[model samples]
Target: MASSRGGSGAVGRANELEKMSIEQLKALKEQADMEVNLLQDSLSNIRTATSRLENATTALNDLSLCPQGLLLQTLSLSVWVPRKSKKL
Candidate 1:
């Protein structure tokens, strides 16, 4: 068993890794790479969701500030129409 070190954990891990067989190291590397890919995918999804939420919030704010008469028209397009232009 490897002893746990606080700040020097990486050094301890390196030492332990040095004692591992080549096949063990290769398997470990494969598992680490898979985890990294999964983390990257999850992060990408989170970013996409955050962006969508921001866009929805901005749309809601814009709708809240719009004049009452244009509410129906705005909902139809789901976007803010220019206040100065009556054209769709």
Candidate 2:
């Protein structure tokens, strides 16, 4: 036997939906359409950001494989290191 008090499963929900007016159904459909549009826009922005990040990562990896001296020159930065003194 099904308990009738609290939990209304799919059948109960379907019965409730069948009682709604056409205008109410139209409003619900419009709301759902807006939600889908918003989600699509968000997904597009995320894909663009992901593409940019991947490009940046690839560029960095390429730079890493270059010799340190060339890398420093390309970036126009200089580093000075002291030489060790010869033993007496």
- Best candidate per TM-score, number? 1
- Top candidate, metric lDDT: 1
Candidate 1, superposed: residue stretches over 4 Å from native: 1-4, 69-88
Collision count of model 2? 0
> What's the TM-score of each model vs. the native?
0.68, 0.63
Candidate models: Cα lDDT each: 0.80, 0.72
Model 1, 1-88: lDDT tens digits are 3545564798888899999999999999999999999999999999999998998998888778867766343435446465554677
Count clashing residue pairs per candidate: 0, 0
* lDDT for residue 29 in candidate 1, whole number 0-100: 96
